[model samples]
Target: MDQRVTIEIIDGVADVRLVRADKMNALDNAMFDGLVEAGETLKLNKQVRCVVLSGEGRAFCAGLDASNFGRMAGGGGGGEPENATSRLGPRTHGISNRAQYAVWVWRELEVPVIAAVHGFAYGGGFQLMLGADMRYVTPDARLSILEIKWGLVPDMAGTQLMRHLVREDLVRELTYTGRIFSGAEAQQMGFATRVCDDPRAEALKVAREIAGKSPDAIRAAKRIYNAANYRSAADGLMDESIEQSSLIGSPNQVEAVKANLEQRAPRFAD
Candidate 1:
Protein backbone atom coordinates (compact mmCIF):
# COMPACT_ATOMS: atom_id res chain seq x y z
CA MET A 1 0.00 0.00 0.00
CA ASP A 2 2.82 2.40 0.82
CA GLN A 3 4.50 1.74 -2.54
CA ARG A 4 1.39 2.42 -4.59
CA VAL A 5 -0.91 4.73 -2.61
CA THR A 6 -0.55 7.31 0.14
CA ILE A 7 -3.08 8.89 2.50
CA GLU A 8 -2.95 12.14 4.45
CA ILE A 9 -5.74 13.50 6.60
CA ILE A 10 -6.01 17.15 7.65
CA ASP A 11 -8.91 19.10 9.17
CA GLY A 12 -11.48 16.40 8.49
CA VAL A 13 -10.45 15.78 4.87
CA ALA A 14 -8.40 12.86 3.62
CA ASP A 15 -6.21 13.21 0.57
CA VAL A 16 -5.67 9.86 -1.12
CA ARG A 17 -3.08 9.81 -3.86
CA LEU A 18 -2.02 7.15 -6.34
CA VAL A 19 1.80 7.22 -6.12
CA ARG A 20 2.94 4.91 -8.94
CA ALA A 21 3.84 7.89 -11.11
CA ASP A 22 6.50 6.28 -13.28
CA LYS A 23 3.91 4.07 -14.93
CA MET A 24 1.16 6.77 -14.93
CA ASN A 25 -0.13 5.37 -11.65
CA ALA A 26 -1.39 2.24 -13.33
CA LEU A 27 -3.46 -0.32 -11.40
CA ASP A 28 -1.19 -3.22 -10.53
CA ASN A 29 -1.83 -5.70 -7.72
CA ALA A 30 -0.27 -3.42 -5.14
CA MET A 31 -2.31 -0.47 -6.38
CA PHE A 32 -5.52 -2.49 -6.12
CA ASP A 33 -4.72 -3.44 -2.54
CA GLY A 34 -3.76 0.10 -1.66
CA LEU A 35 -6.94 1.63 -3.01
CA VAL A 36 -9.12 -0.90 -1.20
CA GLU A 37 -7.23 -0.44 2.04
CA ALA A 38 -7.45 3.34 1.83
CA GLY A 39 -11.19 3.20 1.31
CA GLU A 40 -11.65 0.85 4.22
CA THR A 41 -9.57 3.07 6.46
CA LEU A 42 -11.55 6.17 5.62
CA LYS A 43 -14.86 4.34 5.95
CA LEU A 44 -14.16 3.47 9.57
CA ASN A 45 -12.68 6.83 10.51
CA LYS A 46 -15.55 9.09 11.49
CA GLN A 47 -13.24 12.10 11.69
CA VAL A 48 -12.88 12.13 7.91
CA ARG A 49 -15.71 14.34 6.69
CA CYS A 50 -14.62 14.42 3.04
CA VAL A 51 -12.05 12.90 0.70
CA VAL A 52 -10.06 13.98 -2.38
CA LEU A 53 -8.60 11.27 -4.60
CA SER A 54 -5.94 11.95 -7.22
CA GLY A 55 -2.79 10.50 -8.75
CA GLU A 56 0.82 11.64 -8.76
CA GLY A 57 2.77 12.64 -11.94
CA ARG A 58 1.48 13.14 -15.46
CA ALA A 59 -1.61 10.98 -15.48
CA PHE A 60 -4.38 10.04 -13.12
CA CYS A 61 -4.16 6.38 -14.16
CA ALA A 62 -3.50 4.53 -17.42
CA GLY A 63 -5.79 1.71 -16.35
CA LEU A 64 -4.21 -1.72 -15.87
CA ASP A 65 -0.41 -1.80 -15.75
CA ALA A 66 1.25 -2.82 -19.02
CA SER A 67 3.00 -5.69 -17.23
CA ASN A 68 -0.37 -7.36 -16.70
CA PHE A 69 -0.85 -7.44 -20.46
CA GLY A 70 2.62 -8.86 -20.90
CA ARG A 71 1.80 -11.56 -18.38
CA MET A 72 -1.39 -12.37 -20.31
CA ALA A 73 0.76 -12.79 -23.42
CA GLY A 74 2.83 -15.50 -21.62
CA GLY A 75 5.76 -13.21 -20.81
CA GLY A 76 7.53 -12.80 -17.47
CA GLY A 77 6.15 -10.14 -15.10
CA GLY A 78 6.75 -8.75 -11.62
CA GLY A 79 4.00 -10.55 -9.69
CA GLU A 80 1.97 -13.72 -9.85
CA PRO A 81 -0.62 -13.73 -12.64
CA GLU A 82 -4.26 -13.38 -11.61
CA ASN A 83 -6.92 -15.87 -12.62
CA ALA A 84 -9.91 -13.83 -13.83
CA THR A 85 -12.31 -16.78 -13.87
CA SER A 86 -11.43 -17.71 -10.30
CA ARG A 87 -12.82 -14.38 -9.03
CA LEU A 88 -16.37 -14.59 -10.36
CA GLY A 89 -18.07 -16.88 -7.85
CA PRO A 90 -17.32 -15.35 -4.46
CA ARG A 91 -18.17 -11.97 -2.95
CA THR A 92 -14.84 -11.04 -1.43
CA HIS A 93 -16.12 -7.79 0.14
CA GLY A 94 -19.85 -8.07 0.53
CA ILE A 95 -21.04 -7.31 -3.03
CA SER A 96 -17.74 -6.87 -4.85
CA ASN A 97 -14.78 -9.02 -5.80
CA ARG A 98 -11.21 -7.87 -5.11
CA ALA A 99 -10.94 -5.86 -8.34
CA GLN A 100 -14.38 -4.32 -8.06
CA TYR A 101 -13.86 -3.43 -4.38
CA ALA A 102 -10.85 -1.33 -5.31
CA VAL A 103 -13.30 1.04 -7.02
CA TRP A 104 -16.66 0.34 -5.42
CA VAL A 105 -15.53 0.96 -1.85
CA TRP A 106 -15.36 4.71 -2.46
CA ARG A 107 -19.04 4.74 -3.33
CA GLU A 108 -19.83 2.78 -0.23
CA LEU A 109 -18.30 5.44 2.03
CA GLU A 110 -20.79 7.65 3.81
CA VAL A 111 -18.76 10.82 3.34
CA PRO A 112 -18.46 12.48 -0.04
CA VAL A 113 -15.51 11.56 -2.28
CA ILE A 114 -14.17 13.70 -5.11
CA ALA A 115 -11.87 12.33 -7.82
CA ALA A 116 -9.44 14.78 -9.34
CA VAL A 117 -8.44 13.38 -12.71
CA HIS A 118 -5.79 14.47 -15.19
CA GLY A 119 -3.99 13.00 -18.20
CA PHE A 120 -5.47 9.59 -18.89
CA ALA A 121 -8.18 7.64 -17.01
CA TYR A 122 -8.82 4.51 -19.01
CA GLY A 123 -10.40 1.05 -18.55
CA GLY A 124 -10.33 0.24 -14.84
CA GLY A 125 -9.23 3.77 -14.00
CA PHE A 126 -12.32 5.20 -15.66
CA GLN A 127 -14.45 2.90 -13.53
CA LEU A 128 -12.52 3.97 -10.47
CA MET A 129 -13.43 7.59 -11.09
CA LEU A 130 -17.07 6.59 -11.28
CA GLY A 131 -16.92 5.41 -7.67
CA ALA A 132 -16.47 8.97 -6.45
CA ASP A 133 -19.47 11.18 -5.73
CA MET A 134 -18.05 13.87 -8.03
CA ARG A 135 -15.09 14.24 -10.39
CA TYR A 136 -13.00 17.31 -11.12
CA VAL A 137 -10.92 16.90 -14.28
CA THR A 138 -8.57 18.78 -16.57
CA PRO A 139 -10.16 19.82 -19.82
CA ASP A 140 -7.50 18.12 -21.88
CA ALA A 141 -7.43 14.89 -19.94
CA ARG A 142 -8.12 11.76 -21.98
CA LEU A 143 -10.72 9.22 -20.86
CA SER A 144 -12.08 6.01 -22.30
CA ILE A 145 -13.96 2.82 -21.57
CA LEU A 146 -11.03 0.90 -22.97
CA GLU A 147 -11.54 -2.73 -22.00
CA ILE A 148 -12.81 -3.54 -25.48
CA LYS A 149 -9.32 -2.84 -26.84
CA TRP A 150 -8.14 -5.90 -24.92
CA GLY A 151 -11.25 -7.99 -25.68
CA LEU A 152 -12.69 -7.89 -22.17
CA VAL A 153 -15.80 -6.43 -20.59
CA PRO A 154 -15.55 -3.93 -17.75
CA ASP A 155 -15.62 -6.01 -14.54
CA MET A 156 -14.95 -3.31 -11.95
CA ALA A 157 -18.45 -1.87 -11.43
CA GLY A 158 -18.31 0.24 -14.61
CA THR A 159 -21.55 -1.16 -15.97
CA GLN A 160 -23.38 -0.32 -12.74
CA LEU A 161 -22.02 3.21 -12.34
CA MET A 162 -22.16 4.33 -15.99
CA ARG A 163 -25.90 3.83 -16.13
CA HIS A 164 -26.31 6.38 -13.33
CA LEU A 165 -24.20 8.99 -15.16
CA VAL A 166 -24.70 8.72 -18.94
CA ARG A 167 -27.27 7.85 -21.55
CA GLU A 168 -27.71 4.24 -22.54
CA ASP A 169 -26.72 4.81 -26.19
CA LEU A 170 -23.58 6.75 -25.26
CA VAL A 171 -22.53 4.09 -22.76
CA ARG A 172 -23.03 1.36 -25.36
CA GLU A 173 -21.11 3.35 -27.99
CA LEU A 174 -18.12 3.96 -25.75
CA THR A 175 -18.06 0.39 -24.46
CA TYR A 176 -18.14 -1.06 -27.96
CA THR A 177 -15.64 1.29 -29.64
CA GLY A 178 -13.13 2.01 -26.88
CA ARG A 179 -12.78 5.53 -28.26
CA ILE A 180 -11.18 8.28 -26.23
CA PHE A 181 -12.84 11.54 -25.19
CA SER A 182 -11.70 14.75 -23.56
CA GLY A 183 -12.63 15.72 -20.01
CA ALA A 184 -14.66 18.66 -21.36
CA GLU A 185 -16.69 16.15 -23.32
CA ALA A 186 -16.98 14.04 -20.21
CA GLN A 187 -18.53 16.96 -18.31
CA GLN A 188 -20.93 17.58 -21.15
CA MET A 189 -21.86 13.90 -21.15
CA GLY A 190 -22.41 13.98 -17.36
CA PHE A 191 -19.33 11.94 -16.46
CA ALA A 192 -17.45 14.83 -14.79
CA THR A 193 -18.74 17.44 -12.34
CA ARG A 194 -16.40 20.11 -13.72
CA VAL A 195 -13.33 20.61 -15.91
CA CYS A 196 -10.60 22.75 -14.38
CA ASP A 197 -7.07 23.95 -15.13
CA ASP A 198 -5.80 22.22 -11.98
CA PRO A 199 -8.20 19.54 -10.91
CA ARG A 200 -6.43 18.55 -7.69
CA ALA A 201 -6.40 22.07 -6.30
CA GLU A 202 -10.05 22.60 -7.17
CA ALA A 203 -11.00 19.25 -5.68
CA LEU A 204 -9.13 20.11 -2.47
CA LYS A 205 -10.91 23.45 -2.25
CA VAL A 206 -14.29 21.80 -2.57
CA ALA A 207 -13.38 19.09 -0.11
CA ARG A 208 -12.41 21.65 2.50
CA GLU A 209 -15.67 23.49 2.01
CA ILE A 210 -17.56 20.23 2.58
CA ALA A 211 -15.47 19.52 5.65
CA GLY A 212 -16.71 22.73 7.27
CA LYS A 213 -20.28 21.49 7.34
CA SER A 214 -21.78 19.39 10.12
CA PRO A 215 -20.21 15.97 9.78
CA ASP A 216 -23.38 14.12 10.62
CA ALA A 217 -25.43 16.16 8.14
CA ILE A 218 -22.84 15.71 5.40
CA ARG A 219 -22.82 11.96 5.87
CA ALA A 220 -26.60 11.87 5.89
CA ALA A 221 -26.71 13.85 2.66
CA LYS A 222 -24.39 11.37 0.98
CA ARG A 223 -26.51 8.48 2.13
CA ILE A 224 -29.72 10.10 0.87
CA TYR A 225 -28.20 10.93 -2.49
CA ASN A 226 -26.70 7.48 -2.94
CA ALA A 227 -30.05 5.87 -2.22
CA ALA A 228 -31.80 7.80 -5.01
CA ASN A 229 -30.48 5.52 -7.75
CA TYR A 230 -30.95 2.19 -5.97
CA ARG A 231 -33.98 2.51 -3.71
CA SER A 232 -37.67 2.86 -4.44
CA ALA A 233 -39.04 6.39 -3.99
CA ALA A 234 -41.05 5.31 -0.94
CA ASP A 235 -38.03 3.73 0.67
CA GLY A 236 -35.84 6.72 -0.20
CA LEU A 237 -38.32 9.18 1.31
CA MET A 238 -38.56 7.16 4.48
CA ASP A 239 -34.78 6.96 4.74
CA GLU A 240 -34.51 10.71 4.26
CA SER A 241 -36.79 11.31 7.22
CA ILE A 242 -35.02 8.72 9.33
CA GLU A 243 -31.61 10.20 8.59
CA GLN A 244 -32.84 13.73 9.23
CA SER A 245 -34.40 12.66 12.52
CA SER A 246 -31.10 11.22 13.65
CA LEU A 247 -29.30 14.46 12.84
CA ILE A 248 -31.84 16.95 14.18
CA GLY A 249 -30.71 18.40 17.53
CA SER A 250 -27.59 16.23 17.55
CA PRO A 251 -24.49 17.96 18.98
CA ASN A 252 -23.03 18.66 15.56
CA GLN A 253 -26.37 19.87 14.27
CA VAL A 254 -26.74 22.26 17.21
CA GLU A 255 -23.20 23.47 16.65
CA ALA A 256 -23.95 24.19 13.01
CA VAL A 257 -26.98 26.30 13.94
CA LYS A 258 -25.15 28.12 16.72
CA ALA A 259 -22.19 28.88 14.44
CA ASN A 260 -24.45 30.21 11.71
CA LEU A 261 -26.28 32.46 14.14
CA GLU A 262 -23.01 33.60 15.74
CA GLN A 263 -21.37 34.14 12.31
CA ARG A 264 -18.48 31.81 13.10
CA ALA A 265 -17.18 28.48 11.88
CA PRO A 266 -18.83 25.52 13.56
CA ARG A 267 -16.69 23.43 15.90
CA PHE A 268 -17.95 19.94 15.24
CA ALA A 269 -17.15 16.64 16.86
CA ASP A 270 -16.47 13.50 14.88
Candidate 2:
Protein backbone atom coordinates (compact mmCIF):
# COMPACT_ATOMS: atom_id res chain seq x y z
CA MET A 1 0.00 0.00 0.00
CA ASP A 2 1.09 3.56 -0.65
CA GLN A 3 2.22 5.68 2.28
CA ARG A 4 -0.66 7.60 3.74
CA VAL A 5 1.48 10.66 4.56
CA THR A 6 4.76 12.17 3.42
CA ILE A 7 6.96 14.76 5.06
CA GLU A 8 9.76 16.68 3.41
CA ILE A 9 12.11 19.08 5.14
CA ILE A 10 13.89 21.82 3.26
CA ASP A 11 15.40 25.11 4.37
CA GLY A 12 13.76 24.95 7.80
CA VAL A 13 10.29 24.33 6.41
CA ALA A 14 8.51 21.01 6.83
CA ASP A 15 6.29 20.30 3.86
CA VAL A 16 3.63 17.74 4.76
CA ARG A 17 1.40 16.02 2.29
CA LEU A 18 -1.50 13.63 2.76
CA VAL A 19 -0.46 11.03 0.20
CA ARG A 20 -3.56 8.83 0.00
CA ALA A 21 -4.77 10.41 -3.20
CA ASP A 22 -6.70 7.38 -4.33
CA LYS A 23 -9.19 7.81 -1.51
CA MET A 24 -9.21 11.62 -1.67
CA ASN A 25 -6.94 11.40 1.38
CA ALA A 26 -9.76 10.17 3.52
CA LEU A 27 -9.24 9.34 7.19
CA ASP A 28 -8.75 5.68 8.03
CA ASN A 29 -6.69 3.76 10.58
CA ALA A 30 -3.50 4.03 8.58
CA MET A 31 -4.08 7.67 7.75
CA PHE A 32 -4.74 8.43 11.39
CA ASP A 33 -1.41 6.89 12.37
CA GLY A 34 0.29 8.86 9.63
CA LEU A 35 -1.15 12.19 10.74
CA VAL A 36 -0.43 11.60 14.40
CA GLU A 37 3.08 10.43 13.63
CA ALA A 38 3.67 13.46 11.47
CA GLY A 39 2.51 15.82 14.18
CA GLU A 40 4.57 14.05 16.81
CA THR A 41 7.65 14.03 14.60
CA LEU A 42 7.29 17.75 14.05
CA LYS A 43 7.12 18.37 17.77
CA LEU A 44 10.71 17.17 18.18
CA ASN A 45 12.10 18.60 14.95
CA LYS A 46 13.66 21.81 16.18
CA GLN A 47 15.05 22.55 12.73
CA VAL A 48 11.57 23.17 11.41
CA ARG A 49 10.55 26.82 11.39
CA CYS A 50 7.36 26.52 9.37
CA VAL A 51 5.01 23.89 7.92
CA VAL A 52 2.93 23.75 4.77
CA LEU A 53 0.16 21.12 4.79
CA SER A 54 -1.74 19.97 1.74
CA GLY A 55 -3.12 16.89 0.04
CA GLU A 56 -2.13 15.14 -3.17
CA GLY A 57 -4.34 14.51 -6.23
CA ARG A 58 -7.78 15.91 -6.98
CA ALA A 59 -9.21 16.87 -3.62
CA PHE A 60 -7.70 17.92 -0.34
CA CYS A 61 -9.73 15.23 1.47
CA ALA A 62 -13.18 13.66 1.20
CA GLY A 63 -13.52 13.02 4.95
CA LEU A 64 -13.71 9.57 6.54
CA ASP A 65 -13.59 6.40 4.46
CA ALA A 66 -16.86 4.59 3.81
CA SER A 67 -15.42 1.38 5.22
CA ASN A 68 -14.93 3.14 8.55
CA PHE A 69 -18.59 4.04 8.54
CA GLY A 70 -19.51 0.48 7.72
CA ARG A 71 -17.53 -0.80 10.67
CA MET A 72 -19.09 1.77 12.96
CA ALA A 73 -22.56 0.90 11.81
CA GLY A 74 -21.94 -2.80 12.19
CA GLY A 75 -20.46 -2.35 15.63
CA GLY A 76 -23.13 0.09 16.72
CA GLY A 77 -20.93 3.15 16.23
CA GLY A 78 -18.17 1.66 18.33
CA GLY A 79 -14.90 -0.01 17.44
CA GLU A 80 -13.71 -3.63 17.63
CA PRO A 81 -13.64 -4.75 21.27
CA GLU A 82 -9.89 -5.23 21.36
CA ASN A 83 -8.89 -2.01 19.62
CA ALA A 84 -7.95 1.28 21.27
CA THR A 85 -10.45 2.90 18.91
CA SER A 86 -13.11 0.85 20.64
CA ARG A 87 -12.55 2.71 23.87
CA LEU A 88 -11.80 6.17 22.49
CA GLY A 89 -13.15 6.30 18.93
CA PRO A 90 -16.88 5.99 19.16
CA ARG A 91 -18.72 7.41 16.18
CA THR A 92 -20.61 10.21 17.74
CA HIS A 93 -22.85 12.31 15.49
CA GLY A 94 -21.33 10.76 12.38
CA ILE A 95 -17.75 11.53 13.36
CA SER A 96 -15.66 9.04 15.27
CA ASN A 97 -13.80 10.69 18.14
CA ARG A 98 -10.42 9.60 16.78
CA ALA A 99 -11.13 11.41 13.51
CA GLN A 100 -11.37 14.73 15.36
CA TYR A 101 -7.78 14.35 16.56
CA ALA A 102 -6.62 14.39 12.94
CA VAL A 103 -7.27 18.13 12.89
CA TRP A 104 -6.72 19.01 16.54
CA VAL A 105 -3.06 18.01 16.45
CA TRP A 106 -2.18 20.81 14.05
CA ARG A 107 -3.41 23.40 16.50
CA GLU A 108 -1.01 21.93 19.03
CA LEU A 109 2.02 22.59 16.85
CA GLU A 110 4.12 25.43 18.24
CA VAL A 111 5.18 26.80 14.90
CA PRO A 112 2.75 28.18 12.35
CA VAL A 113 1.13 25.84 9.84
CA ILE A 114 -0.63 26.77 6.61
CA ALA A 115 -3.17 24.51 4.97
CA ALA A 116 -3.33 24.64 1.18
CA VAL A 117 -6.65 23.32 0.03
CA HIS A 118 -8.00 22.50 -3.41
CA GLY A 119 -10.93 20.73 -4.99
CA PHE A 120 -13.43 19.39 -2.51
CA ALA A 121 -12.98 19.64 1.30
CA TYR A 122 -16.09 18.30 2.88
CA GLY A 123 -17.28 17.05 6.27
CA GLY A 124 -14.23 16.18 8.36
CA GLY A 125 -11.95 17.49 5.64
CA PHE A 126 -13.30 20.99 6.19
CA GLN A 127 -12.69 20.71 9.92
CA LEU A 128 -9.21 19.39 9.27
CA MET A 129 -8.34 22.64 7.53
CA LEU A 130 -9.63 24.51 10.53
CA GLY A 131 -6.74 23.22 12.67
CA ALA A 132 -4.12 25.19 10.78
CA ASP A 133 -3.07 28.73 11.63
CA MET A 134 -4.14 29.89 8.19
CA ARG A 135 -5.72 28.36 5.12
CA TYR A 136 -5.25 29.23 1.47
CA VAL A 137 -7.90 27.71 -0.75
CA THR A 138 -8.35 27.44 -4.51
CA PRO A 139 -11.07 29.70 -5.90
CA ASP A 140 -13.03 26.84 -7.41
CA ALA A 141 -12.58 24.52 -4.45
CA ARG A 142 -15.73 23.16 -2.86
CA LEU A 143 -16.12 23.20 0.95
CA SER A 144 -18.91 22.15 3.24
CA ILE A 145 -19.77 21.54 6.87
CA LEU A 146 -21.29 18.28 5.66
CA GLU A 147 -21.83 16.17 8.77
CA ILE A 148 -25.52 17.00 8.88
CA LYS A 149 -26.08 15.24 5.58
CA TRP A 150 -24.72 12.07 7.12
CA GLY A 151 -26.87 12.61 10.20
CA LEU A 152 -24.15 14.21 12.30
CA VAL A 153 -22.70 17.40 13.68
CA PRO A 154 -19.21 18.90 13.37
CA ASP A 155 -17.86 16.74 16.20
CA MET A 156 -14.27 17.49 15.40
CA ALA A 157 -12.66 20.71 16.63
CA GLY A 158 -15.11 22.61 14.41
CA THR A 159 -17.14 24.00 17.28
CA GLN A 160 -14.04 25.56 18.83
CA LEU A 161 -12.41 27.02 15.71
CA MET A 162 -15.65 28.21 14.17
CA ARG A 163 -16.41 30.31 17.22
CA HIS A 164 -13.86 32.95 16.21
CA LEU A 165 -14.06 32.76 12.41
CA VAL A 166 -17.84 32.78 12.00
CA ARG A 167 -20.86 34.34 13.57
CA GLU A 168 -23.05 32.14 15.76
CA ASP A 169 -25.94 32.10 13.30
CA LEU A 170 -23.65 31.49 10.35
CA VAL A 171 -22.04 28.53 12.11
CA ARG A 172 -25.50 27.22 12.91
CA GLU A 173 -26.66 27.62 9.34
CA LEU A 174 -23.68 25.80 7.87
CA THR A 175 -23.68 23.05 10.47
CA TYR A 176 -27.41 22.50 10.31
CA THR A 177 -27.73 22.53 6.54
CA GLY A 178 -24.46 20.86 5.41
CA ARG A 179 -24.41 23.31 2.54
CA ILE A 180 -21.53 23.33 0.08
CA PHE A 181 -19.88 26.66 -0.69
CA SER A 182 -17.13 27.84 -2.99
CA GLY A 183 -13.71 28.82 -1.69
CA ALA A 184 -14.49 32.45 -2.45
CA GLU A 185 -17.54 32.15 -0.26
CA ALA A 186 -15.43 30.65 2.50
CA GLN A 187 -13.04 33.59 2.23
CA GLN A 188 -15.96 35.96 2.58
CA MET A 189 -17.25 33.99 5.52
CA GLY A 190 -13.77 34.18 7.18
CA PHE A 191 -13.05 30.45 6.93
CA ALA A 192 -10.27 31.05 4.40
CA THR A 193 -7.47 33.62 4.40
CA ARG A 194 -7.50 33.96 0.61
CA VAL A 195 -8.71 32.26 -2.54
CA CYS A 196 -6.34 31.63 -5.40
CA ASP A 197 -5.82 29.37 -8.40
CA ASP A 198 -2.76 27.82 -6.76
CA PRO A 199 -3.34 27.54 -3.05
CA ARG A 200 -0.21 25.50 -2.28
CA ALA A 201 2.01 27.97 -4.14
CA GLU A 202 0.46 30.90 -2.33
CA ALA A 203 0.74 29.18 1.03
CA LEU A 204 4.42 28.37 0.46
CA LYS A 205 5.04 31.92 -0.67
CA VAL A 206 3.71 33.12 2.66
CA ALA A 207 5.40 30.43 4.75
CA ARG A 208 8.81 31.20 3.26
CA GLU A 209 8.33 34.83 4.12
CA ILE A 210 7.58 33.88 7.70
CA ALA A 211 10.55 31.53 7.86
CA GLY A 212 12.83 34.40 6.87
CA LYS A 213 11.91 36.45 9.92
CA SER A 214 12.88 36.12 13.59
CA PRO A 215 11.62 32.72 14.73
CA ASP A 216 11.26 33.76 18.37
CA ALA A 217 9.20 36.83 17.56
CA ILE A 218 7.04 34.92 15.14
CA ARG A 219 6.34 32.18 17.69
CA ALA A 220 5.61 34.76 20.37
CA ALA A 221 3.15 36.47 18.10
CA LYS A 222 1.41 33.18 17.33
CA ARG A 223 1.07 32.46 21.02
CA ILE A 224 -0.50 35.84 21.63
CA TYR A 225 -2.84 35.48 18.71
CA ASN A 226 -3.94 32.02 19.75
CA ALA A 227 -4.50 33.21 23.29
CA ALA A 228 -6.63 36.15 22.19
CA ASN A 229 -9.19 33.86 20.61
CA TYR A 230 -10.22 32.37 23.96
CA ARG A 231 -9.25 35.14 26.34
CA SER A 232 -11.11 38.15 27.67
CA ALA A 233 -10.10 41.56 26.37
CA ALA A 234 -8.57 42.51 29.73
CA ASP A 235 -6.64 39.25 29.83
CA GLY A 236 -5.64 39.67 26.22
CA LEU A 237 -4.26 43.10 26.93
CA MET A 238 -2.30 41.78 29.86
CA ASP A 239 -0.86 38.99 27.73
CA GLU A 240 0.12 41.47 25.05
CA SER A 241 1.86 43.61 27.63
CA ILE A 242 3.70 40.66 29.13
CA GLU A 243 4.74 39.30 25.76
CA GLN A 244 6.03 42.68 24.58
CA SER A 245 7.97 43.17 27.78
CA SER A 246 9.55 39.75 27.43
CA LEU A 247 10.61 40.38 23.82
CA ILE A 248 12.04 43.88 24.24
CA GLY A 249 15.41 42.93 25.75
CA SER A 250 15.71 39.29 24.66
CA PRO A 251 19.01 38.35 22.92
CA ASN A 252 17.33 37.19 19.70
CA GLN A 253 15.17 40.30 19.66
CA VAL A 254 18.26 42.48 20.01
CA GLU A 255 19.73 40.55 17.09
CA ALA A 256 16.64 41.41 15.05
CA VAL A 257 17.25 45.13 15.56
CA LYS A 258 21.01 44.84 15.00
CA ALA A 259 20.54 42.82 11.81
CA ASN A 260 18.35 45.50 10.31
CA LEU A 261 20.73 48.29 11.32
CA GLU A 262 23.84 46.46 10.06
CA GLN A 263 22.07 45.20 6.93
CA ARG A 264 23.09 41.62 7.77
CA ALA A 265 20.96 38.51 8.16
CA PRO A 266 19.94 37.54 11.69
CA ARG A 267 20.77 34.01 12.85
CA PHE A 268 18.20 32.88 15.39
CA ALA A 269 18.43 30.01 17.84
CA ASP A 270 15.64 27.56 18.23
Among these predicted structures, which one has the highest lDDT?
1
Q: For candidate 1, lDDT tens digit of each residue in 15-118?
A: 99999999999998899999999999999998999999999999999998866654433312123334323334346776667777898799889999999999
Error of 2 at 134 (Å): 0.6
Error of model 2, residue 236, in angstroms: 20
Cα-based lDDT at residue 71, candidate 1: 43
For candidate 2, write residues 206-252 as lDDT tens digits.
88888888888878887888777745433332332333334433455
**RMSD in angstroms between candidate 1 and the native structure over all alpha carbons:** 17.9
Residue 227, candidate 2: C-alpha displacement in angstroms: 2.2
Question: Considering summed lDDT, which 10 consecutive residues are worst modelled in model 2?
Answer: 233-242
Top-TM-score structure, candidate number: 1
TM-score of 1: 0.82
Q: Estimate each model's TM-score.
A: 0.82, 0.78
Poorly placed runs, candidate 1 (over 4 Å): 75-84, 231-270
